[model samples]
Target: MKTIITSALVLGLSLSFSVSAVADDDAMMQAAGKELFNKCSACHSLDSSKNAFGPDLSGVVGRKAASLPRFAYSEALQKSDITWTEANLRKWIAGNDQFVPGTRMRHVEITDKAEQDYLIAYLKTL
Candidate 1:
């Protein structure tokens, strides 16, 4: 009985450590994502301080598409009923035209999975 209990405790500690280690990935992803968004800094502002060619994307992680005030969203974008999610952002960034037909964004697809993961992480923080 003592041997079994000790082994169980050890196993539990190992499992807990593994779970905690996995959570570190989320922070890493967020850091990586910020680096990816540097490319977007030219045309978009993630900070609320100002707007650029694109609407400010602050807090855009779960926001509805075209929901920002003052930006003139195209009819195509305004009517799409799209919501930004990690998966949807990936699609939109990869090919905006496919996601919203007739929209005007022209960014080239981000090809690195790590970068995309990081970008989504950064967007969530916005």
Candidate 2:
């Protein structure tokens, strides 16, 4: 009985450490992503609903494409009928032109997959 109790305690401790490690990794990824967002700040606003050259990205993760009535979106985007799923966001970040032909956003493609992952992680927090 004592051996079984010890094994259970060990398992619990291992799971706790695993969870803590994952949380730490996620926080680090989000921090990296926030740093990457500096490149986008020139044309985008993340903290508020105010639109700049691009619509505000505060709640963009699950939002529909071209949904902001105030922001004049490209015709291609308006017609794309897209939901900003993580996969779609990844493709969009990689290359907006390829993702949506004639997209007005002049964003440079983020070619690094790791960078894209980091950016997505940060975006999810918003």
Candidate 3:
């Protein structure tokens, strides 16, 4: 009976550890998204008060697709008629101009879902 109890305890501990490992993986994925954003940094700025070659993206997560003031968006993005939701942002990052057909951003695709989610989640925090 003591042996059986020990085995059950071991199993429970292993399951708990497995769950913790999965949570770690999720956290790592979010970190990967921030890494992905580095590629876009040349043109984009995270700070709302500062403008880059691209528009400032301080509140872009929930902002309209092509509604930044002063900065000129390509005719393509201007007409996308879409909002910047996580799903849509994923699609955009996978291949920006291709997805929107007229966006000025060059075609760079971040195909990993974890990376995409991480980047989108970070954007929401901005």
Candidate 4:
């Protein structure tokens, strides 16, 4: 009985440590993502619905592309029928023009996958 209890305790502690590590990793990723978002802040606003050179990205994850009524989105984007899934976001962030031809926002490609992941992580928190 004592051995079983010790084993259970060890398992519980291991699981707790794993969960904590994952949380720490997520926090670090989000922090890095926030810093990387500087590249987008000039054109995108995460705090409000106001449109700038780009539409507000306050809730962009899971949102439809070109869905903001107030913003004048490119015809291509408006018709693309895209849901901003993480995979799609990765593609869009890497190259908007390549992802959707004739996109009005001329974003420089973010080629580094890790950086893209970081930015996406930050965007998710918005």
Candidate 5:
């Protein structure tokens, strides 16, 4: 009976730890996303229908490239047939020039894959 109790306790503790770890990871990712977004804040706006130097990023996660009706996009981006999927967004952030050459916004790359993921996750919230 004591051995069974001990095993149950161990299992409970392990499950608790697993839950905690997942929560901690989520928190950390959010923090990283916020930090990374600062670099984009100068050009992009999070509010709907509000565009700064760049178009509003309020729903950018699943949005197609250069698809904001109010914002004038570069010819290169307008001509490109890129959709902002998770993989595409990751690639775009990591290397904008490579992703779309002749883009007016010449430099907008987030090289770190983890950081890119976090930023993408945060963008989905907008």
Candidate 6:
């Protein structure tokens, strides 16, 4: 009985540490993503209510493409059925042409998967 209780306690402590590590990793990733957004800040607004050249990205993680009421979206994006999941966002960032052909964002150059992951993480904060 004592051995079983000790093992359970060890397992619980290990799980706690694992969760904490994940939280730390997420925070670090978000920070890296924020730095990457400096390039995008020229066009995209992180504020939900503020639309810049691009629509505000607040709460975009699960949002439908071209759904922001205040901003004008390209016809292709407007017609798209995409829900902004992480995978879709990654593709959009790396190359919108491949993900959604005819997207107006034709010159975006980010292609590194790690960088995209960080940017997506930062975007999630908004």
| Highest TM-score scorer | 2
Worst 10 residues of 6 by lDDT: 45-54
Order candidates by lDDT, high to low. 2, 4, 6, 5, 1, 3
Candidate 3: TM-score?
0.73
Per-model TM-score on C-alpha atoms: 0.84, 0.91, 0.73, 0.90, 0.86, 0.82
Give the per-residue lDDT of model 6 (tens digit) for 22-113: 99999999999999999888888766666578888888999999998877788889888999999888878887887888877755768898
lDDT of 1 by residue, 14-42 (tens): 99998988788888888888877888888
Error of 6 at 44 (Å): 0.6
Q: In candidate 3, list every pair of residues with a backbone clash.
A: 76-102
Which structure is stronger by lDDT: 1 or 5? 5
In order, candidate lDDTs are 0.83, 0.91, 0.81, 0.90, 0.86, 0.87
Extract clashing residue pairs from model 2.
Answer: none
Error of 5 at 26 (Å): 1.2
Candidate 6 total steric clashes: 0
* lDDT, model 3: 0.81
Error of 4 at 48 (Å): 2.3
Off by over 4 Å in 6: 1-12
Total clashes for model 1:
3
19-121 per-residue lDDT for model 2 (tens digits) = 9999999999999999999988889976465658988887799999999878899999999999999999999999999999999999579989999999999
lDDT of 6: 0.87
Clashes of each: 3, 0, 1, 0, 0, 0
- State the TM-score for model 5: 0.86
Candidate 2: where is the Cα deviation over 4 Å? 47-49
The CA lDDT at 44 in model 5 is: 87
Write model 3 residue lDDT over 1-126, tens digit each, in one string: 999999999999999999999889767766776787798888888765676888877678878987977898888888889898878888988888679886777788888887788888667656
